[model samples]
Target: MTDTTALSQTETVQSKADVVQVTALTGSIGAAISGVRLTNINDDQFVAIRTAFHEYCMLVFRDQFLSVEEHVAFTARWGEFGFNKMSPQLDDYPMVLPLSNRGKSKAVTENWHYDSTFMTEPPAITTLSARDIPVGGDTMWSNQYLAYETLSPGLKAMLAGVRAEFTGTRLAKLYGLDQVPRCLHPVVRTHPETGRKALYIGKPGDTVPRFEGMTPTESEPLLRFLYEHSAQPDHIYRHQWRNGDLVMWDNRCTMHYAVHDYGNEMRELHRVTISGDRPV
Candidate 1:
């Protein structure tokens, strides 16, 4: 099939057990599934949805036109949500976080990094729904599992006991550290649920002084190398969002960046995070 026509297949509605699994991109960590809607999901249907999310690490539901209240209600089924401290649009629905690069608010994630990893306890899962889609505004998510597993075994072994601080303010400064976050996380993190090892290195400006006992100069190059390699093209999936498209991802195993090529066109999205006990 032609590249453009590949994902053009009409999504078919079906029963929960008969859900269709269609790849959004050739080798990405996410899948666009058909046959279900989140707004009025049943227990069994949600189970299947959660299963798909765990296996794929990310899941996208298309053409699901839902109201703000309905979207927030649906995401709450996954877990408790958080408010967006920097965005004022979340004023109405305190539980939902608004991600907008419009007249009123700036985009929350314009760089590559995991969501809220700077916090002592980061979000476990995040569900984002598009309210408006402007040209050139896309979101890209990277599979950290694949990124970590692809490294040479020797390198993996070297990173076994390593750790680094992940500060949010520093990451925001990549465009300039003018206004950045301050917090720390391990350089190598163990997934709370999956128990798999992942490289949790740089996020824009997160400075890596050292890994365990290494010197700053000694560790900088290696950390930088991994940070660059982890977001390779092969492990990435760039989604061109549409209004009503809902994308959910496991923050424990993924990093995302927003594409801001759409200069003036307004784009808005809402995110609800699922709380986890803690990072393992």
Candidate 2:
């Protein structure tokens, strides 16, 4: 009989070659990658894609069309997939979190915040796929590192010794948590992989307190100023999806928001989060 194993190996390599293609977007914001069906990527191809993702910070894969299992498996190829401890849409697949807002079901993720920052161990990466889309459902992402880099040297100097406190209690109030997360992160943190500093201050539930030597009243206006200036369009990219598209983004240096114009037509997306190391 023919060596089926060799044939399978050959087929996999051929499939990967036929399926993978990468395209970068404008303003150093995002990339549009095509080919290499996620469910069937090989080890070598996966490494290449992972490298591209790190360089791009955000990658958009068109024509994924993965089932929940395949979607979770594809995300697992990059890193450990974390369970969703917040949304009620989680099912038997603990690692798969569904993001949908249909009819009376309100959509979450309306603000610009890093996912699961309340935890002592926050996620490193997050993968999302569109299942359903309304006529105008779109997602936007902003680069925090770029935001910090563009700041005036005077402000950057002022912020050098400043830090902000993030509390789970404040976040808990927004999400209706019985208990708050037990971790705190620096307002400015350095990325372990890239060794770049970024503003790590935006979350839906942040309670701004004085930075030790500074008072709360003295800190709030500056914090708000940084928050507003950091989210400017020069640092933002918006993704308008097509069916079967998958996106994976670095949570360490990016923040995202889901647009609300989809209305009642229904939008379904699945997310898988990768474990993250502490910021330096």
Candidate 3:
């Protein structure tokens, strides 16, 4: 992990004294934020948090045992709520979805994917608060910005302005739905906040059906390469979940895979998503 202080240009000298401590989890992406509480974040602290969020693409807060109300409130600070229709929501708190090993045939997130990319405007951010963690339910996130930036000039030019069809195939299968939800988004999309380009492709048969104006056969090789290249070990940060841990990732700039190694030990998390604009 790389240790660095996060400071915004607009930060005052006094604000600097209270700035949150950010340590990079990996050379490529993610940071661990300390010295602040999400329950009662002041304006200055929020500014620093936002800075670390945009720069790191994912933030990890340890030892935050947030209630459903607190989870919703902190997530709303990011943006409007983006609900997941396929997942079961909490009875009283409809916006919070419970992710558990109670009644699932298989783990839907074992493969890497951006959250709800099938939507016309997929979620910009997703936050998960660990409720009941087992021994090994770690999740890994890959940096999509680095994915796009590392591509060759020719491949980059080829992908520029290209769009792909994203589908909710895995979730559809998991829930035994009749029809899958699908949408078209740019293969490489520019982030609205940071103005950096990120590879928007996914595991072809799983989340992505094919590139627009191309047949499945024509798209397979390139899609496979991009998906594999985007998730190289160097560009990823594997987070081992601890009890009372709350993690948030920018879905627009990252893809995450959930490891299901804990078996039936009962791992549960409360998840909240923030809505985002349509991909341009």
Best by lDDT: 3
True-structure RMSD for candidate 3: 3.7
> What lDDT score is found at residue 121 in candidate 2?
68
> For all candidates, what are the clash counts?
9, 4, 0
The local lDDT score (0 to 100) that residue 34 gets in candidate 3 is 83
Q: What lDDT does the true structure give each of the candidates?
A: 0.71, 0.72, 0.88
Off by over 4 Å in 1: 1-24, 84-89, 102-108, 170-181, 207-216
lDDT of 3 by residue, 64-181 (tens): 9998899899999998999888888999988899999843358888889998888999999999999989898899999998898888889999888899999988889889999999
Off by over 4 Å in 2: 1-20, 102-108, 168-175, 203-215
For each of the candidates, the C-alpha root-mean-square deviation to the true structure, in angstroms, is 5.3, 9.1, 3.7
Better of 2 and 3 by lDDT: 3
TM, every model: 0.83, 0.84, 0.93
Best by TM-score: 3
Of candidate 1, the 10-residue stretch with the lowest lDDT total is 1-10
lDDT of 2 by residue, 136-231 (tens): 778898888877777777877877756566555544665788876645577777888888778787642254344545666777777787777667
Clashing pairs in 2: 19-35, 19-36, 20-36, 64-244
